[model samples]
Target: MIDVVVIGGGPAGMSAALVAGRGKKQVILIDEEKPRNAVTHETHAFLTRDGTKPEVFREKGRRDLLKYPTISIKNSKVLSIEKKAEDTFEITTESGDIINAKNIVLATGVTETLPNVKGIENYYGSSIFSCPFCDGWEMKDRPLILIAESVQALHVLKLLKNWTDNLIVTTNGNKIFDTDQKKMLEINNIRLIEERIIELKGIDGELQSIFFESGEKINRSGGFCTTVLDNRLPFIAQLGIKVNEAGFVIADVMGHTNIKGIYAAGEITGPSQLIVSASQGHMAGAGIIADSCEEAFQSIQK
Candidate 1:
């Protein structure tokens, strides 16, 4: 059996496999190569790597891991994971390969559902985005639109103010905000639109304008959205893993889940930056090393 199997090839899984491989343990990092960040043009907030393209960052990360002889990366999707016994798991891949591992690290991240607006996919990660901190600077001081349908969007509007005062927020015909929130937007000079969006006009992934059902057209160079997150995992249901109310896995500081020999890290635990996810993977790898060493020591004592 492999010493460790990491079920995501993102920064967290790769980092965990790297550390474990450096500890002289055999590791397999499996990934489907379909990453959420592939939609974005650039990534931000990682020192020395800020503004780097997502695919470039991933390629560089793979290069670093290639130096370790004990580490292997499998470019395939994991179809299912079955706990065969204590400290043993059988992972079935889409390619019909079954990999057995003594330890498992789940770095599977969450997926975001952009607001249900036509042509939104074209502008996402380009002229429109979800995270402000990631793309706010590039869109600073431009006429921006916020397509949000929830009350929580009020907070996002406040964050956008730091980048531009020329802001317009629309609820897509959903009046989900309280009266106080409406008053707050009015006081801040943020125009609020409560009509349904008819269409988003853009060219070459660049957002040019938004057409509302009320026959109103607003020109916006770039903007942001408050997207819904989906973090559900098939393994969680099969293995009965512990998760918080928000669908995030409940793991310790070292990334140990409630189940023995199973660990979790990265965005599945919570929304985290790239560096933070990598750091969590490192800790989880260290935890695996400690556990393996202790088990070996106990066997030697016997």
Candidate 2:
């Protein structure tokens, strides 16, 4: 049995595997190669990897991780996971292979649900994005739109204000915000348009304008959108791991979930900066090692 099986090979998973291997634990990293940031041209705010392509960072991480003989990576998807016994988990892959590990780390990030508007898909990650901290600098001083269908719209609007003063919030026909929230946005000079977005006008994955169903067109350079994220796998539900209201895994500071022998990090736990997710992975790895050591010591005493 492996010491730890990390699902997902993104930054968080890679970091976890690296740390676990360094801790003298046998590790297996499984990834389907469909990183959430695959469409992003560049990743920002990462110390040395700022402005680096997402794929390039993953390539470097993979190369470095391979240097550890105790860590192995597989290009496959986890189909299911089951508790075989106390302190052990059995995982089944899409290829029908079964693997058992003492602990599991779920770094399976979320997939974004884009606006139903036409042409938005082509511009996602290029001109349209979700995280202001990640892509806001590139779109600074430009006319932007905050496309949201829930209270998250207010949060996105507040953050985008730092990047550009010229901004509009497209409610996309949802009026979920309360009166006070509406007043707060108005007082801040952020226009809220409760119109359904019909389409996006763009050229070759670069957004230019938003066309609303009310015959209104908002010309925008780029903007942020709130996405409805669904967990990539039902593992959280099947394994009875507690999740937040937002459908994210609930874990402690060190990435310990309510379910023993299971941990989670990255976007699966909560929305975080890339560097923050990597740091969380390192902490989770350390926690796993600490827990294992305690278990071993207790067994020896018995």
In terms of lDDT, model 2 sits at 0.88
TM-score of each: 0.97, 0.95
For every model shown, the clashing-pair count is 0, 0
Best by TM-score: 1
lDDT of 2 by residue, 1-302 (tens): 88999999888888888998999999999998888889999999999999999989999999999999999999899999999876699999987779999999999888778866666778889998999999999999989888887787777888899999998888888887889988998898988898888888988888888888889888988888988887868778888999988888998877899989999888899888789889888888888989988989999999
Tens digits of per-residue lDDT, candidate 1, 206-258, equal 99999999999999998999887767678877988899988899999888999
Task: Point to the candidate with the largest lDDT.
Answer: 1
Would you list the clashing residue pairs of candidate 1? none
Over 4 Å off in model 1, which ranges?
Answer: none
